[model samples]
Target: MEKFTLELLFHIIGIGAASGLIYKDNSLFVIGDNSGFLYEYHIDSQDLKRHPLIENPSENILKKEKPDFEALTHFQDSLYIFGSGSTPKRNAMVEFDLAQKKKTDTKNLTNLYEVMQNFSSIKPEDFNIEGVIFEGENWYFFNRGNGISNKNTLFKLHAKKLDQEFSMTSIDYKLPKIKGVRTSFTDAVLVDNKIYFLATAEDTQSTYHDGEVLGSIIGRIDIETMKIDFTKKISDSHKFEGLTVYKNDNKTIELLLCEDKDTEILETTIYKLSLNLK
Candidate 1:
C-alpha cells in the first residue's frame, strides 16, 4: 500500500473548519464548513477565496447551541450543500449555481423540517446529515445518528426527481465496534468502481472537550457484492475529509485528499496519494 504525502497547507480563519470538498475541475475546488461557509480555492495557485452561502445577515434565522453537520457536493454544474440545524430549520439539502457572477445563496432542495411538520411520525432531530455523494441517478448521504450511538447510517436520495421525497435507509456495511471509540462516517468519493470514505473516530476515553482524535483510511466497497475492504490507513495528524481523483500527464490517476482542519491551530495539510489499482 502507498502512503499519503502532504502537499500544501492553507490558513483560513473563522471558516468553522472545513468538512467537505468537491473538485469542480483541474483548478477549482469547493469546500464547505460547519459555519455554513463555502469557499472556492485554486489547486495550482494555492489561492483561497471565501463565500458565505448561508449566513444570517439579518440575524433572523434561529441560532443553535452547537455547530451543524455541513457537507457539500457538485452535480449538474451546481454546488449542493447539506446540513442539520434547529427546528423549522432541521436538516436540509440545498443547491447553488456557481456560474453566476454574483454570490449564489443556497436553495432548499430537501427540507427535513417540512417533512417533520407533515409527518408527525418522523422527528427532525433524528436527521444529522454529514456528507453527500452522487453516483449516476442515485445520491448517497452519510448521516451521523445522535452522538450517543456509534452507528453511522447512510441514506439514499434519488437524483432524478427533486420533487420526490427523500427516503432514508440503512447501508449494509457493518462498522467495527472499537471500545471507547465514537466513529462517524463523514464523506465519500467513487474511484475505479470503488467507494472511498472519510470518517472520524473519537477516543471516548478522553473528555468530549479534550479535542477529537482523528484518523483516515481508504476503503473499497464493491457495489456488486456489497462488501467493504478497508485496505489502507493514512498515517498523518491532519484529518482527511474530502477526496477527488484527478488525471496527471500520461493519463496517470492521482488522488487528492483534502485536509479539513484549522491550519493555524491544527495540523492542516492536504495530501496527494497515488493509486495503483491492480
Candidate 2:
C-alpha cells in the first residue's frame, strides 16, 4: 500500500474559511466557521451558490451570538448541521427540509452537551466539538481538546427513534503525543468499513479561541473495534478543518479538505488529496 498525496487545488477569499463539508444533491456544501450561510458548489463545475442560513430565528430560539456551526452530515435524505458547542452558543442541530427549502426542526441538545462537558478535563469554558458521522445506525461525535483544555473524547449515540434525546457513550481513543502543539480530531468520514479522521493541532492555549496554524494530518480507526488503526502526517504546519472522502474511478481515494488559518480577510484554501488504498 502506498501513501496518500494531498495537493492544493483552489483558493478563495472569504469563502473557504470552512469548518465542515457535506455532499448532497450532487453538489458539495462547505460551511464557514462564523457564517450563517452554506457555500454550495457543483461537483465538477465552477458554479458556486450560497444557500440560506440553516438556522432561522423564527424556527430557533434567538441566540445572542452567531452559532459557530462546525460539523455537517446527512442520513436518509435528511441533512444535519451541528454547532461547535465550544462557546456561549448553545448546543443545537438543524434539520433541512428539501421540499420546503428551509430548516424544519431546530432542537436544543443541552443534555448531550452536558454529558460531554462533564467528561472533559479542562475548564468549562475551554471545551470544543468539531466532527460527527453516522455509521452502523449510530452517530459518532468527535471532540477536539488542546493542552489547555486537556481532553479529547469520542462519543457514540443511537438515534433510531429518538428525536432530540441523545444517550451518548464515550468510546476509547488514544493518540501518541505530539511535541510543540496539542493535537485532536477535527473532522471524519466513513470509507469502506473504516472511519478516517482528520486530526489537527494549532498553537493555542484553549480550544475555544483561535491559535497559530500548526499542523494537520489524517488517520483511521476500525469501525467494528472502534480503535485507532494508522495515522499519516500530511502537513506539519497547516490547518485543515473540513474533510470529504470518497472513491473515484473505483480505484482511487479522493479527499477534499479546507483550511482555516484564523486570518483577517485572507482567502481560505481548499486542497485535493489522492491516494491508493492498496
Give the top-scoring candidate (TM-score).
2
Candidate 2 error regions (>4 Å):
12-16, 54-64, 98-100, 119-123, 147-149, 161-167, 177-179, 248-251, 264-266
Candidate 1 residue pairs in clash (backbone atoms < 3 Å):
none
Instruction: Please write out the lDDT profile of model 2 over residues 100-155, one tens digit for every residue.
Output: 55667777776667767775443556566788887537888888766464566787
Candidate 2 differs from the real structure by a C-alpha RMSD in angstroms, to one decimal, of: 3.6
Task: Give each model's whole-structure lDDT.
Answer: 0.52, 0.70
Worst ten in a row by lDDT for model 1 = 57-66
What is the lDDT, from 0 to 100, of the residue 214 in candidate 2?
67
Candidate 2, lDDT over the whole model: 0.70
Query: Model 1: per-residue lDDT, tens digit, 36-139?
Result: 44566676666666565555521112234223435666667677666643233434555667776224554454454444323333234444555677765767
